[model samples]
Target: MAALIDAIDVKRKTTFELEGVPYYCLDADISSPTARGGQTLVRLRMRNMLTRAVFDKTFKASDKFKEPDLQTIPATYLYSDGDGSYFLDQESFETLQLGEAMVDDALELMVEGLAIQIDLFNGNPIGLTLPAQVELAVRSTEPGVKGDTASGGVTKAAVMETGLEIRVPFFIKEGERLKVTTETREFAGRA
Candidate 1:
């Protein structure tokens, strides 16, 4: 049997199970009553682990949720094909496949041999948790001419090896490795 957590305890990045499906909390807000003896509401922005859907719902502060059987393990990017993207679990040496919907925009940040974390629910792969930053090589971009850096905050479009296009600084050139922040999908710095 799993332990239960009260709604008031739920916060950002919390994982709990409702019914039989696992849910990840993106954000949580608690609203207290202005008058006496009023019920408190815990509004949460949650994402469905299996379906990758995001929605908002409100629950009473006293509501209880069962902690989910979720685990994250290190994995290495293997390849992608007609079926979906593949990864090799570093801990167990097992091969895992995540569907297109599950991979989604994350594919743009992945490259062969990249290290990442895979989220598992009830011993089955549910979704992927990307690293905060990743190193990607620029596949193509306009040439950076001399003195371009004189204009501060200038940027140009660049395509990464994994097909992600991002606005890089004007001094960035083709074939240079860059640090990219996964959450915002923006250029971080030189790698």
Candidate 2:
């Protein structure tokens, strides 16, 4: 039997069907807003339960949903090679490889052997969400000193080992590990 859920409960484990296809949408919002001009808009964050694809859509507040069955599974990050990204099923001990296209925006935050939770439907992997923070090493950057007041306060452009560039504090150096926020890629602190 299919499960039913309200739009407000979308963030949790819930399901709904659209055109006969089941989908699990997470961290979604469905609400009506009153604007300055007295106009109203409905916003939504939806993920395809089958494909694990996410998208935002706006609709009239009058619309409603019919629920579907939602399931959850635990997965772990194995490794990534030129071939593709791989994950190990915690419960089944099965490993699966996902193409670059499947990872989408989450690719930029990946690190070797990092474990993360994945949303799936009917045994197909859909979306990859990473931790809020991650630590990485600096690969290259110009040197900076404590008393260097020549460039504003104190900042340096450092390239992470992953090849992503970030503006770090003046004291950071090559090979030094630093904490970074996955959402903004901003430097958090020295690790």
Candidate 3:
């Protein structure tokens, strides 16, 4: 049997089940009552594991939730086809094909052989979690002018091998490897 967690204990990344559906906590905020002996409230921004829907709701601090049966397994990007994207589970060596809606924006950051974690509910793959940063090879960019820096904070558009376009320093050029933040899709630094 899974354990029950109080609403007041919910935090970012917490996973719990409500009414037989699993939800992941994206953010949580607690409000203290202004008056004495008043009810405390916990507001949470939650995402549905099955439908990917997100919403915010408030619950009493005493509310309880059952921990869902969830697990994250290491996987490697295998390839993509007309059907969907494929991944190889490191532990069981099984191939998983996720639908377009499931892969979504994460596909733009993926490269062949990239290591990532896949969330599994019960026994089925549910979500993809990318690393905070990823190294990608620059596919193309314009040449940097010698005095480009004179203007200060000069940046140029660059395309990565995976077709993700992002702004990079003027000095960045084709074939160079660069670190990029997955959340913001911004250039971090040279790989």
Q: List the residue pairs that clash in candidate 1.
A: none
TM-score of each: 0.92, 0.71, 0.91
Tell how far residue 123 is off in model 3, in angstroms.
1.0
What lDDT does the true structure give each of the candidates?
0.94, 0.71, 0.94
The TM-score, computed over Cα atoms with residue i paired to residue i, of candidate 1 is 0.92
**Candidate 2 residue pairs in clash (backbone atoms < 3 Å):** 11-27, 23-49, 24-49, 52-126
Residue 131 miss distance in model 2 (angstroms): 0.8
**Where in model 3 is the C-alpha error above 4 Å?**
31-38
Candidate 2 residues 1-191, lDDT tens each? Answer: 55544444455445667666676555555554456655344456666755667877665544456664344566777777798789887788898777777776566666777667776655677656677888888999998865777666577899987778889888787999988898898999987
Best by TM-score: 1
lDDT of 1 by residue, 13-78 (tens): 999999899999999999999999999999999999999889999999999999999999999999
Give the number of colliding residue pairs in candidate 2: 4
The order by descending TM-score is 1, 3, 2
In candidate 3, list every pair of residues with a backbone clash.
Answer: none
The sequence of per-residue lDDT tens digits that candidate 3 reaches over residues 1-191 is 89999999999998899988899999999999999999999999999998999999999999999999999999999999999999999999999988888898888899999999998889888889999999999999999999999898999999999999999999998999999999999999999
